[model samples]
Target: MFSFIIRRVLLVIPTFLAIAFLTFVAIRLVPGDPVEARTGERGISPERLAHFRHELGLDQPVWKQFLDYLWQIAHGDFGTSISTQTPILTEFTTLFPATLELAICAMLFATILGIPAGVIAATRRGTFVDYTLMGAALTGFSMPIFWWGLLLILFFSVDLGWTPVSGRIDLLYYFEPVTGFMLIDSWLSGQEGAFSSAVSHLILPTIVLGTIPLATIARMTRSAMLEILGEDYVRTARAKGLSPFRVVGIHALRNALIPVVTVIGLQVGALMAGAVLTEYIFSWPGIGSWLIESIQRRDYPVLQGGILLVSGIVIVINILVDLLYGVLNPRIRHAR
Candidate 1:
């Protein structure tokens, strides 16, 4: 297990490098002049434009610029954002936790609801319960996030006035950002109603972001449980007069979880991608919204660095999930 972990950790370096290089090259290929983005088309002088490019090292050959970027990255510099003029790392540290908080909430919502729904559907098999549940999952999986988020806002925020329209919390509450997570920070603040406010604001976006993951999880769980339920061991357990709930929940569900865990782990990447749309619709101040702004302003460093970091996180989580297989099924560990 130690050797396996070490191998995965080592692989992360090359994977990170490959993602970074691809992002760097891909951003340049997008037809937009960062200088022009910074300075309008009408007013900027030729000499000023040239100076700006030179200062940003855009005047250098592409290979030279790429090499300099690599060297800077090696020294732990993501470089400054051309538009914001802030260190990419600093911006990341500030904004990333917001995304993380949202993602965690979204995943929790998915898992809490999804797993049981799947189990119920599987157990019911050919009944209306199964059909209805599977139908809902398909709908959730097929719907676009932005549309779903907007519809939720219109219903809950606009018509019903049940939740805040946007933002992580109402601006009326003042709390020092200790962890950059609103829910925790609200509790830490001791400000009355702050935690509740954060939760209310979180509901719409969480539902929007989690819908796909929930649906996917439900489907995968249902499929896995169905297969496990038919196994010889399941039949034996049933014949042994074990309670149906115990037989299914303890034995069948546990065995079925390997694939379900894999699906859940893979959904992290999807959640991040979906967060982009969800954040935009809800106007949430997270890395997703920040990345959108960076793209508009043509901030190359933030674009490349942010994508690299998020991808790196996804890769790490996937590695952890693979390791978890050994814990879930000891045979995997012994085989390795």
Candidate 2:
């Protein structure tokens, strides 16, 4: 596992360069110039624009700028945001953890709910229980995460007064921004007030982001479970007087989880991608919301840095999932 992880890490270096190179070229290919975007109409004159260009190294050749940026990245600098003039790495580092927390929570909710729901549907095939679970999963799949978030807020918060509308905590509670995750800090500090507010605030967004993954997991789980249940081992288990519950849960569920894990991993990557909309809706201080603002302002450094960061995360998670496949299913390991 250690050697495998090291190999994956080594591979990501070239992957990063390739993604960065393509992204840099693609963004620059867009019609508007960042310099003009900065100056705006009736703004700075040509001389000032020229000075700004020199200051930002925009006067340099494109390849030179790209190579310079890569060099800086190698040295742990992500450059300053074009609009804000703040270090892109600092800004992103502060914001990303919040999004990470939200994504992790959503993934957990999806796994906790989706897999079991799928298994239930599979085990109870052709029954009302099966239909109801699958029906719910289908509906969940159809709903967009942002739309789902708004509906949840409207119904649960406004109409029902069940949960908070936005943000990560009650304004009244006012938990310190330790670790950028209110729920985590609340638990870490053992403060009931903070914990309650954090959990309550997380309710709507978590459910919203969790819905699609739940649907995907449920469908995969059902399919995998059905296939596993039909395997001869399952038949033999039943023939050996194993209870239906054990036959399905113990005998089939673990094996079925291999593919389900992959689905969940891909879902996690999607959740991070979707988080931009989710954070914007919820007014959460996360990378997605920040990235959107950067793009809107043509903040080149921030945009590129954020995209690379997300790409790296998605890539890492996928590699982790691949390694887990070997760990879970010994056939692959033995074949190796």
Candidate 3:
């Protein structure tokens, strides 16, 4: 297991380099010039434009620029943002925790609801329960997150006033950010209503962000369970007069978790991708929204760094998932 983890960790370096390189190239390929974009309509003089380009090192050859970027990154520098002029890495660090919080909550929401729905559907195959659950999964899978967020806002926030329309917490509750995760920090602060305010603000976005993952997990779970249920071991367990709960929960569910785990891992990546839309709709300050702003400003450093950071996170999660497979089924670890 240690060797497996080391190997996976080693692989992440090359993968990250590839992603970083691609992001660098892609951002440069985009037509807008960051200097020009920053200066906008009544632009600067030719000499000023040239000075700006040189100052940003854009005047250098592409190879030198990339090498410099690599060198900077290797030294733990992500450069200054073209727009905000903040250190890209610092900006990323500040925003990433919020995105992480949202993704974690979204995953929790999905896993809590999706797995059981799937198990029930699989066990009750061909029945009304199966059809109803599966149908709901399909709807959730197909629903647009932005639209869903808006609808949730309309119903829960605008109409019922059950939840806040947007933001991480109510502005009324002033607490210093310690951990960066509002939910935890709120509780840690011991301020009145802080925790509830954070949760209230999180509800709509979490549901919107979790919907597709929940649907995907449910479908995958149902499929995996269906297959596992027919396996000889399951039959043997049933024949041995194991209780329904033991047969399904212990025997069937554990075995079926491999595929479900895969879906859940992939859903982490999906949540990051989906958070852009969900965050925008809810006005949540996270990396996703930050990335969008960077693009608008043609902030190449932030764009490249953000993409690299996000991809790195996704890759790490996937590697962790691979490790989990070994734990889930020892056969896989032994095979490796």
Candidate 4:
């Protein structure tokens, strides 16, 4: 198990470098100059433009710039944002808690409901319950994040007025964010209706963000459970006069979870990607919105560093998931 973990951790170095290089090059390839973006509408003199370029090191060759970038990253400097002048790491830490909170809520929403839904669908394979649940999952998986988010806002916010149209919490409740997570901070504030307001604000965004993950997890769980149910051990458990719940839940579900957990881990990337659209639509103050603003302004440092950090997080999570595989199924560690 230790060796398996070490190998996975070792693999992250090359993967991180590849991601950093690709993100550096790809953002640069996009049309628009950061200097031009900064001096929008008013424009600048040729000498001024040259000075800005030189100051930003854009006057250097691409290879040199990349090497400098690598060196800066190696020294734990993500560089100041060309547009905001704020350190990328500082901005990310400030905003990331909001994204983390939203992502956690969305994943919890998906996992809490999706696992049971999948279990029921698999257990009643040929029944109407299976068909209905699977159909719903398919529909959810196929829905576009932007469209779904809008429809939800229109219905819940506009027509019914059941939820806030956008933002993390009500503007009426102003308090220092000790944790940066609105739900927890609001509760800690001890103001009337603060926590409830936070929850209300989160509802539509969470549902929209969680929909795809929920569908994917449900389908994967169902598939794994179905396969596990037919395994010899499951049948043996049943033959040994164990209860149906123990046969399926204890025996089949445990093995089924190996693949389900993998799918769940893979969903982190999807959730982050989806958060961009979800945050835009809902106006959530998270990393997704921050990245979008940076892109619009052609903030190269923020774009490159933000993407690199996000990718690093995803890579770390996936490595943790791989380690979890050894815990969930001892055979995986033994095989390694």
Candidate 5:
């Protein structure tokens, strides 16, 4: 297990490098110059323009610029944003964790809701429960995240008055900055009231963002559970007089988790990818919204940095999920 984990962790480096390189190249190929885009129609004088290019290192050869960028990246410098004039890494820190939390909450919500719903649906196969759960899952799986977010806003925010439609925290509740995340900081500061408010604000977006992934997990879990329940081992366990709960929960469910874990991991990645829409809808300040702003402004450095961070996060999560397979099914890992 240790050896396998080591291997998986080691593999993340090159994979991230490849993603970073691809993102950098792709951003460069886009048809607008960050400087020119920001400078607008009043063309600057030749010397001033040259100075700007040199400042940004655009005056250097393409290959040299790439290598220089690589060197800077190695030293933890992500370049200054043309639009914001802030270090790319600096902006990323402010934005990344918000999205990370949102994605995590959404993922957890999905799995918690999806898995149990799936288990019940599978256990009660061909029943009304199955039909009802499947129908809900189908709607969730088919609906778009953006569309879901708007619906949630309309229903929960406007009509029901159950939750706030957008933002990460209630402006009425002030929180001290301890960890940069409002909920955590609020808790650490012993302000449960603020924390509760923050959580309330998060509920709608979390559900809206999570619905699709939840559906995915439920569908996968149901399918996998059904397949496992019909296997010889399941019958053997039942024949041995094990209680139905023990047979299903302890034996079949444990083994069925391998594929479900895979689906959940993929859904996690999907949630992170889907957050751009979620963030926009909620007006949540996060990397996804930053990416959108970068694209609109042609802030290549910001765009590349954000893309690399997300790709790296997704890759790392996938690697962790791959490692989970060994833990879930030792037979697969120990197989000759």
Candidate 6:
């Protein structure tokens, strides 16, 4: 298990390098010049442009710039945002909690409901319940996030007036963000209706963000459960006259969770990707919105650093998930 964990941790180095390099190259390949974009119309003089480029180290050769970027990151410096003049790391930390909160809520929403739904579907295979649940999962998987978000907003927010249109909380509640997670902070603030308001604001965004993950998790769970249920132990447990719940839940579900856990971990990336669209639609104040604003202004440092940071987070999560495989199924560690 220790060796397996070490291997996974070591693998992150190369993975991070690859992601960082690709993000660096890809952002540079985009047409807009950050300096020019920041300056906007009524362009600066040629000398001034040259100075700006040099100041940003853009005048350096691509190889040198890449090396410098690597060196800076190695030293824990993500560099100051070209647009904000603030350290990228500082801005990321400030905004990350919101994204973290949303992602957590979304994943919780998916896992809480998806697992049971999948179990039911698999247990009742070939029945109407199975078909209906599977169909809903397929529809959810197929839905475009932006379109789904709008549809929900129109119905729930616009017409029925059940939820707020955007933002993390109602403007009426103003208090210092103790934890940056509105739900927790609201409760901590002891402000009347603050916690409820935060929950209400989170509802639509969580649903929109969680839909695909829920679908994926549910389908994966069903597949895993189906296979596990067919195992000899499952039949043996049933033949032994164990309760149906014990046969399925304890024996089958535990063994089945290995693959389902992997799917859930992979969903972190999906949740983050989906958060961009959901945040934009709901005007949620998270890193997704921050990244969008940076992109509009062609903020290269923020774009590159932000993407690298996000990728690092995803890679770390995947590593943790890989380690969890050992705990779920001891055979995985033994095999390694």
For this target, which candidate reaches the highest lDDT against the unseen true structure?
Answer: 4
All candidates' lDDT scores?
0.92, 0.86, 0.91, 0.92, 0.84, 0.92
TM-score of each: 0.98, 0.93, 0.97, 0.97, 0.91, 0.97
Instruction: For candidate 1, write residues 1-336 as lDDT tens digits.
Output: 788889989988888888878888888888866998877667688899899889888899988888898888889988888877889999999999989999999999999999999999999999999999999999999999988888898999999999999999988899679999999999999999999999999999999999999999999999999999999999999999999999999999999999999999999999999988889999999999999988888888899889987897899889988989778988898998
Q: Write the per-residue lDDT of candidate 2 for residues 1-336, one digit (tens) a residue.
A: 667678889999999999899888877887656688866776778798889889889899999999999999999888888887888878987888888888889889989989889999998999999999999999999998778888888999999999988888777665566787777788776766878888988877888878888899999999999999899999988999988889989889989999998888788678887788889889887898898887666777888988998998899899988888888888976665
Summarize candidate 3's per-residue lDDT along 164-280 as a digit string, tens digits: 998999888897889999999999999999999999999889999999999999999999999999999999999999999999999999999998998888888788889988888
Clashes of each: 0, 0, 0, 0, 0, 0
Residue 256 error, candidate 1, Å: 0.6
User: Residue-wise lDDT of candidate 6 within 1-336, one digit each (tens)?
Assistant: 677668878878998899888878887888878988978888899999999899888999988999999999999999998877999999999999999999999999999989989999999999999999999999999999999999999999999999999999999999998889999999999989999999999999999999999999999999999999999999999999999999989999999889999999899998899998899999998899999998888888898899989988988888888788877898877787
Q: Whole-model lDDT, candidate 3? A: 0.91
lDDT by residue for model 4 (1-336), tens:
677678878888898899889988987888877999878889899999999899989999999999999999999999998877899999999999999999999999999999989999999998999999999999999999999999998998999999999999988999998999999999999999999999999999999999999999999999999999989999999999999999988999999999999999999999999998899999999999999999888898898899988888888888888888888998877787
RMSD of 4: 1.2
Clashes of 3: 0
Residue 201 displacement in candidate 2 (angstroms): 0.8
Best by TM-score: 1
Report the lDDT of model 2 for residue 31: 64
Clashing pairs in 1: none
> What TM-score, to 2 decimals, does candidate 4 have?
0.97
